[model samples]
Target: MLITEKKHGIRFAQRMSDLGTETAFVVLAKARQLESQGRTIVHLEIGEPDFETPAHIVDEAVRALKAGATHYGPSPGLPEARQAIARYVSETRRVPVDFERVVITPGAKPIMFYTILALVDEGDEVIYPNPGFPIYESVIRFVGGRPVPIQLHEENDFRLDVGELLDLVTDRTKLIIINSPQNPTGSILTAEDLEAVGRLALDRDIYILADEIYSRIIYEGDFTSILHVVPEAMDQVILLDGMSKTFAMTGWRLGWGVMQPTLAAAVAKLQTNSNSCTATFSQMVIPPALFGPQGPVEAMRAEFQRRRDAIVAGLNRIDRITCRKPAGAFYVFPNTSRLGVDSQTLADRMLQEAGVAALSGTAFGRFGEGYLRFSYANSIENIKLGLERVEAFVAKL
Candidate 1:
């Protein structure tokens, strides 16, 4: 009321306009709105795992809380948590990782945000996979960096071409981001693909941010990490991973980054300025989640594989819509271009008419046009029901 009483308006920073958002949350709100009006929505719009967090993780959090783990921890993270993550990554990737290089955060997005802030100068170019995570471009632009997109073509099975990526690099290139098993398209980068990018980073002295959050959810073959593929480039690589995807602990808001110690120090300083530290009790669960029995993780992965098969088959059976079986992650990027409208319109229609909530491909990037992303993180019954509704909607078209 005080501000409204004045004739002048408050001004937001110009950078606010440059920041984009994850469209899944927007669709989620609309889906919830429709549900309030008595419609049943089969939600595949959001990427969160539908399963509960395994009990052991929750038990650790409760135990820690009871033991007075609620106080503020170090800005970088609790030392024990970082050490645990280091050991876990070392054993899995087969590349020795120093605990000193790991920095924990409230969630993985903070790592992404802090990284761009730490490395990118104004007007510097950052190459990232288009139709990848929207936050990658959003943070880059927010920090006044030029976003150079390396398109991931569906024909190439949505994998980034190393030659194409290198073509986009210039004197201004400072950072390159690669996500795999990637978001939206759900494509895993091959060992050969990882090696090519790693070698390029080594030669050009560019930093690579490898988003390996879904590394534990692969359907075929052992998951390959960039650190394993090119151990020499370890100093130049920043790994973004967390318990969110693997442990179904998205709401726990716990994640960490592994990078060169110097950069980790800088990112840790940024963490100090921003979130202070991830919640103490949340950080307490990291050790057990990483070292405990991995059965729950494997169970979820197996279930996701089953759901992936069901959704891909059901989507392909629909007239004019074809979906690729994703090698990892819980999403399926289905081509809906054969229909008359663009991605957003189809997505809107799917929600309004069919009560099936999903995201437009363009939500990820412009290259995402003519496609739509659906997270198969829902149940088989919901996936089947959503597919049926979408089939009916398409038939009416």
Candidate 2:
């Protein structure tokens, strides 16, 4: 094989240069490398659950495949799957969404990207949480929108301050992204905060992108949705969720977006130009995942709670390490400022010296500079060992 450079001056979009990336997969690759070299690495990097997909859900998918439900269904989604999602949202979250307004996609990420592309324009502004999901910023920049961050601080339990968020919004602000039981920090937005955001969205005539992917994974109080507080805002709000986090079906590549009919049609057009539609068999399994027995989801939540307790308690015991007990999701964002080093240095030292894999909080955004994110998706035993390794590493510092 010969390697040669392109002869012509190949032009690329300038926006591509400003795009960012998610670092969880990068850390996961490094962890696998260490494991291959005979190092026993306990992975707490990626935010995936340790549970298998519920038996009934898997069986449903198999049944669909065997029944020859493998042809391309619809550009938006199979009508049945869309209706199931509409019912699930209405019954579970008390969010009234019409079936015609739902567009199913391969995963939540694609919906997010499409939403950014639809609302963002050159020099427009998009607001998102700092130390949050990196893709929010990545896609915003990919669409040539200026990313304005809503800084979620540890003092505030990583919750978005409504007033501060509103202050950042201006006439050019096209979209605001909100994530509850958020990635990395695992902080849930309070009902009051949601109401405040909804009111602002209504008053400002700005669009809201509510990411409820982890809505069902809460360990504390009831899960809330922005759509519940301001139903009229539904016309301007886009809700993105799926079976990935709730049903432990991440690899199945299934998710759906809820928006107004016009916005849904626009996203559907984008989907038609891009992926066409989610896999037919996967769409066939969504109804069972949403309406079937929910015991497996509850069991997964309980296990995550156990691991969360173990890791939080263990980190608190370790010197020069401080971790807040996350109220939802499967991550613990701990302040490593007491260690007198940045998050990246601490993460590197932990991976290289202790053979433990965790993400540098800074990888999410600059607001995460002095923190590290530990995903509690593994077993209790592995969490214990990982904490032990972290303790040893911190002690040496």
- What lDDT score belongs to each candidate, Candidate 1 first? 0.94, 0.90
Per-candidate clash tally = 0, 0
Cα lDDT tens digits for candidate 1, 79-124: 9999999998899878888899999998898989999999999999
What local lDDT does model 1 show for residue 198? 94
Model 2: worst 10 consecutive residues (lDDT sum) = 1-10
* Poorly placed runs, candidate 2 (over 4 Å): 1-12
- Model 1 vs. true fold: TM: 0.99
TM-score of each: 0.99, 0.97
Name the lDDT value of residue 233 in candidate 1.
Answer: 94
Candidate 2 contains a number of clashing pairs equal to 0
List residue ranges in candidate 1 displaced over 4 A. Answer: 4-9
